[model samples]
Target chain A: MFKNFFPNKILSLSNNLLNSLLVYLILVMFLGLIYSLYISPPDYIQGDSVRIMYVHVPSSFISLACFGIIGIASILNLVFKIKFIPLMSKSLAPVGCTFTLISIVTGSLWGKPTWGTWWAWDARLTSMVILLLFYFGYIFVWKFVSSFNKANKISSIIAIIGLLNLPVIKYSVDWWNTLHQPSSITLTSAPTIHYSMLIPLIIMLAGMIIYLLIIFLMKYKTETIKFKMNKIKNKK
Target chain B: MLGKNAKKRAILLTLLLLLSAVTIFLIFKSLEENIVYFFTPSEIYNKQNISFNKTIRVGGLVKENSISKEQNSVKFIITDFKNEIIVSYSGLIPNLFSEGKGVIAEGELKDKKYFIAEKILAKHDENYMPPEVTKALEKSNK
Candidate 1:
């Protein structure tokens, strides 16, 4: 019954959604900037430097989320023989790596002021480094392996294995004595932050997520087109 | 074509899994000991054969009215409400360093009770305390 839904229409829908989301993304980001800079009160302790969380936290969240997507998409590709899922996973790698890089850089800037140092071999920080290495390793697998099936299988395994790091990263502070603070927000409890600060953080998170979606869709579309073009060339 | 390639792929998959398992095990094993950077005053107090000069981190709440500023150094006591140790630091303190706040000081102990902190990290915000500090506080409270 649902088979009538055509791929062309789905692509067109995503394109339209992407255009509108791009606009919304900019608008939300600007609002987030205003809130982060002006509306939210300086932290009771760290003061203005705490503003970095608006960028740092959202980027960290998105980067970790990207890994989760890559892991899931890889599984679906391997099991269900989905063609686009591998490309989607591949497209996510660079974006995830970029966000992780941003988070690390901003985290350093934030840490230097508050933690009295720019870097530490703290559990949370170390696990994040490992996550970045996994991203690089996944991308390298795709590049090095010439056989398409082999590349997909190996990269998918890498992505799945890398999933072990995500839980460790999230729980590192709780499980180990590290310089990183425990999370202020948790799933079961209300946020520890004030409503004013939390509001801007939410807005920033929303903006970052929409931006990631736009990039993901764009990458997927480009890869699909390239795949089709290569197919035509092979026919010729 | 897939069936022809299955044997090689199976071998590759098994090897990759074994490689990752060993790598992860090594990482966790190496990280296990160094993971706990800070020890509470109670924990430090209860320990025997303590090295008097090895650098360590002591995390706890700053005892109220314990802060005294000198020309170049500041002295205070960190307490877990069960045990306390005096910390002396000759440097610029973090912005959040204040009495009645959570802090972690890294330095060697002059003896068992006096800590000379080379670096001090105060709590980042009202809502955030280093997880170790919270855990130490919880354990000591019990």
Candidate 2:
């Protein structure tokens, strides 16, 4: 079962899948952008500024999702002692970091027009900043550690620790009196947002997921190639 | 078969993770009061000891038809429905500030029913809809 997760297997499969993924990504992102920017109606209360949700919400969601993937992969690597698992998490870190940064920046831009302040020390906002710091710590561990096995061990520990922050970030708004409002869409209940707005949001979210897949595959490919090169050099 | 060393490492790692999680939970639990961004009108009223001079935030809905504007100053009532606070401020309110909308006032408490706000921020709810939908909803409500 785990043999399918091997680096060589995944690398070969990803090479073939990458082109189709790119085509779908471009098409989805194009449609997503048009729908979010024009086709969707402007918010009644927020007016045009509400359009920022198209980018901000999706970015935040992707960032959280990327971290989740890293955390789970780290756990599996630790338990099963899989050599290639660390590579997957390592490739995912930069993508997660980039999305976290995007979420914070877009959120700040949205905050100014909507929340009447550029930043607040509210629970929801503070937890997100903490998440970005965790991402930074995880990436830095891989960069600074000289030995591959040592780096993998240390980074896995960091990711597992960082996993603790995920729930705090998700429930921060509900658990505290936050300037940020509670989530409008939840899996357990009907979304409060109108379909006209929700449709574009879903499209944008899909586009973002595809975009993440593309970036992850590219990074994973590069890392695998480097691993192969290093292995050949070691044998020689 | 899994090595005994790997089994020991796994157990140790699990302990470490659990210990840290408990520590974090305790820390957050201790800091609960400090973590709240603002107090509701009722919360302020319920508090036994609240400093009059210390600046704090009070958040709630702006009561309907309670706004009064004058040169360089404005007055409105902030209510959580159960309790209400009369807020007085002299500042440029945010664009979303209006009657019967969510708002937060950060300032000093003058008394039980009065507050002197230094800055006012508008708080929008989670609901999002187009202008036409909002208009239709308003009409239906009326």
Candidate 3:
């Protein structure tokens, strides 16, 4: 565990690139949190309960984004046969799963008061739950399959098929008039939220994003080391 | 080399997760100020230092014939089989909130046993009557 911190690339990350990434993350988190928490106005109806949207909405965005990345990585692994691509996708499963869980938990928590129930099998919630299940199945497939080559082949197909759930999750609210709230941050609808709530939400989202990036890179670095160790052991 | 990399990952993960958790928790603290909690009638009695200044949820059944109102302020009784709670709600309640049904009141506990409820949650099983109420009623009858 101690060895994971000093990965070759991380240690060798040039001063410029390292500083730039740090700066980029800092700025992104700051602006995003501020925009989401402070800049947006509260809904005309829910008053303050509308505040949950800033955090819930962004986390849900990130969750979908992570799944999208997994899909791309899966494709790259299948077509180009890139070893690292599959690893990248594999590393993302848990992060995506965590975000999905948070989104569901917070969404349910918010729903109990607003929608009058802790959970409803609404379209948006149902689709996300399906996506989450796909994540678990896709991840376990790789973990249980020792042969990386075989796992990669299978996961690529699974990810591509699972991509279907993403569109379903995204549009479930848009297409269906479900009890789950329609998105506030869409291109057309002016965010019906206030700045006081938006600012903190954006800040937290940025913080979460930075947190995810740091973990992803760190996990990737760890996997690289394990790969090297396995190669060395096979040679011995 | 492995040891060093492993150590770095550990530190990095710890720092990142810590920062994330703290930031989110801080935001959560502020967010909760605008939210309410649900508790049963017995819970309201059990909790020490109950204050009436804010909002929370008191979960229980509406005592029969206990609901009364004086213009804006409506008073009701919530029971959890173990104990009964007196609630003074100052707002509109959900359609399902009625006497002899399970409801979770959201408001503040005022004056020890009294709760100034602001929102009422009518717990439903499939269509109505949450199973907790059914079970509690059976127990009382037995």
Candidate 4:
């Protein structure tokens, strides 16, 4: 049933989805900001600084999520010889890198007011730093290697290799004793967060994901078009 | 019986996989010791021949009314239900540091009973005080 899913139909669907998603994203982001800035109660201990969680948490989540998509695309490329997967993975690196950077910066801003330091060599923070380096190394391979096949082969390897770090990053808090607290939200149980705080957090998470989707789709479309144009030019 | 190009690709893929496997193995092997950043009070208490003045971390909730301010330092007790350790620190505590809150103190163990903290880390939840801390404090009170 899924065999006839052609590229043209998928592209058009993505376009329509992208338009609505953008509008929805903007509206949701606005509402989320309102709740984060005004509605949520100040933390009993950390006070207003806890509001930084709205940005810091979502950015870090999206950063890891971007790498996850890249890893999946790399796996498909490696196993199934999918032509566009490498480019899609390439498109995601910058988005992942940018969000990783945001996560670190916002985390530092949050840390200063709460942890009394801008940076710590704690496990979570260090693992995130390593993730950022992996993103950079992946992007570096794509840019420095001019041959398409060469870039694809090496970049995919980097993406696949980086997969080992994801589990480490996710489990770092539980497996290690670091300044970073263990995650309160778990898959098997109810979250420890209050509904008032969780609502805005969920909204912001949705907004960030939609934003990532918009950027990733745009990058994918551009790369696909560029490949098609080059092919046509080469034929002439 | 593979084509020449397929043979090369397979070799390259295998090499990459092997390289990544070795890299990950080395990283985790080297990091094994540093992985566990802090120990609970119970974990510390159960250890034998523990040297004093060597730095370590013990994590638990700050026992209520255990904090006493002195001219140069502040002292408090951290407990993990079955065990407790006193921590002394001269520096300013983080904003999140409070009685009945989860904390991890890093410093030399003067003994199992006292921790001269070089640093004190008080953990806070996304919304409020973390639940495990409340549970620990309650358990100790009982």
Candidate 5:
């Protein structure tokens, strides 16, 4: 029982945590480069230009995943009505926004080489732009509303409703044929990606997911601590 | 005062959360299975296909001596250094697309090597050069 409470237990575990995490980061980066450049066989068709999937697909996954967190945090706040819940949701906004921003920025970068144009009004692209706007509105709601309870009130509504755009983004291509190409790998269909390419992609995405988790945990811990400290100070 | 504020806030927050959860669940359920990637011609020949399954991209160079406006389709010779491929695009080619420029058309693969292009991607221009080219040039000089 005493051992469970010891500082050594927690301290020692966390000591090498940073080092092991560093190794994981380097390993993922190396694998990502290797898979895209070497391991992955070129598309029998698109050839090397197909390598953008390594970056684009994973970033899009992260974008979707980040917003999922917002939905969960919002639900927890409602059920528990915990003060901490809203505070955590508030802290999550910037991170989710950052992921969404990366998705759009990289998509634009990849567009120049592939699509031959910097921008398009294509349905998928347009819905994504709307998603970006929703993110801005979500952040704005939190920033402008001074009262914590009131801010939580408004932000929760926006986050839930904003989700309407996610489906629009997905179906935009199927709903209407546009410049954006149709999805290649499907749930029932075999993946069109070659193994050499697929392995590295999976590795890179795993690294990104882990990296996001580490940051989210760190952020949550810091926020919780600050909240506690503020509470104590008020009492004093 | 505190009790009223807390209760009212809780009620509003609950309704919003329930609606949002259902909506987000719908989004997750709707995630697409297939993903697409784009490519350039030279990269296709040199690297092979980069996607997982059957790869797709436009293949051709501007067909020399063949390019002319026949109604909507512009005919051209898409050539590598060795062999030439023929292409017909009905829609507008970007201003950058012209004779002598390398291009890769995207669409279905017809027969053995023929590509029936649905979209045209006109290749490089004076304003653009692959970063790899400069790096490779520098490395060679070194």
Candidate 6:
């Protein structure tokens, strides 16, 4: 069943695709770094410290998106009993965890210059910490649970429960009087940020997303190889 | 096999429903208790029984021309545009702290009208623009 889902041809194609993506990722990252660090204008209030937003915003966004992917994949695995979906979630968990950590760290750095404190127990910050814990819990289940079937079910349920925190994290600023400012760019309204800063931010976001794709593809490939090896051992 | 699948689905659905229900109840309860990160000046005014000893944060805009620097302490009026509270702080303020900018002062309320801030934090809005653009906007507003 796993072999059917990830055939040799598909694996080879993914290898080629990963090579092309790597090239693109390098080029985009170079441009993104240049634009965010030098080309972007300093904020009227924050000056150079505002550059941290280029990294902080993208990491936060990617962390949230990765969890969303994990949650949906877990639900599908549970409902349809898709044998390969667990592999995808397993590959994604670490990437999400790393990005969540990056977001928290960069946010703290940014907070010091702007909010005048290294950390605050504001709703947005606290909820993000909760999200990080959820990611840890999800990864922990997969690591400690030795049985494959039990690990899959337990991790999926953990991912699903973590999904509940996403909305809370997104809405925490608006719902509560957090030190973190409300989102400038919302789906419902025009962005309040100026074009000069917005361009670099978008570029950085694109670069980080490409980086995430690269990492995820590499991890998925490794997991697939491991899965095949396990199956062969079972047959032996 | 179909019965087993149905049973699994039912269990998963019940779990999701129960989890969400509990989450909603907790959120509502927290809201009722008002777990606010910071209270606005207007909110402080609206509170029925105000505490004096407890350290709380009051966030608002620094009223233009309301800043008065003394030898050791700086005094400013924080206004939510509805009500205002006088704040005096001796500590070093954040770089972004200025007239007409948002700020949050953490300290005990001496009274309904006065706040003695132990720490002062600058609160910037979400708007990010170049210095020139800000200057132009400020100029145009005047």
TM-score of only chain B in every candidate structure: 0.66, 0.90, 0.57, 0.66, 0.46, 0.83
What candidate 5 gets wrong by more than 4 Å, as runs, is A1-19, B1-142
Please provide TM-scores computed only on chain A for all of the candidate models, following their numbering. Answer: 0.92, 0.95, 0.81, 0.92, 0.83, 0.94
Model 3 agreement with the true structure over A119-151: per-residue lDDT tens digits: 755567877888888888888898898987888
Per lDDT, what order, best first?
2, 6, 1, 4, 3, 5
Quick one: RMSD of model 4? 4.6
DockQ of each: 0.27, 0.74, 0.02, 0.35, 0.07, 0.69
Q: Kindly indicate the candidate among 2 and 4 with the higher DockQ.
A: 2
Comparing 1 with 6 on TM-score, the higher-scoring candidate is 6
lDDT of model 1 at residue A28?
99
Model 1 lDDT per residue over B1-142, tens place = 3554555655565576568778876887786756776888988899888888788888888999999999999999999899999999998788778888778999999876899999898745338323445567689999
Model 4 TM-score (B-chain only): 0.66
* TM values, all candidates: 0.84, 0.94, 0.55, 0.84, 0.61, 0.93
The candidates, ranked best first by DockQ, are: 2, 6, 4, 1, 5, 3
Best by DockQ: 2
In the range B1-142, model 4's lDDT, one tens digit per residue, is 6667656766776687778878876887788657766788888888887768677778888999999999989999999889999889998788788888888788999878888998877766534533445567679999
lDDT of 2 by residue, B1-142 (tens): 7688778777887898899999999999999888899999999999998899998999999999999999999999999999999999998888889988889899999997999999888888999999999889989999
Q: How far is candidate 5 from the true structure (C-alpha RMSD, Å)?
A: 12.9
Once model 2 is optimally superposed onto the true structure by TM-score, how far is the C-alpha of residue A114 displaced, in angstroms?
1.1
Q: What's the distance in Å from true for residue B66, model 4?
A: 1.1
Off by over 4 Å in 6: A1-10, B1-11, B21-25, B31-34
Q: After superposition, how far is residue B52 of candidate 5 from its true place, in Å?
A: 42
Query: Across residues B33-138, which tens digit of lDDT does each residue of candidate 5 receive?
Result: 2221233344444544344234365444565665777877776766665555455567857644666665656665543334456677654421222345446767
When 2 and 3 are scored with TM-score, the better candidate is: 2
Query: What ranges in model 3 sit over 4 Å off?
Result: A1-44, B1-142
* TM-score for predicted model 2 compared with the true structure: 0.94
What are the per-model numbers of colliding residue pairs? Answer: 0, 0, 40, 1, 25, 0
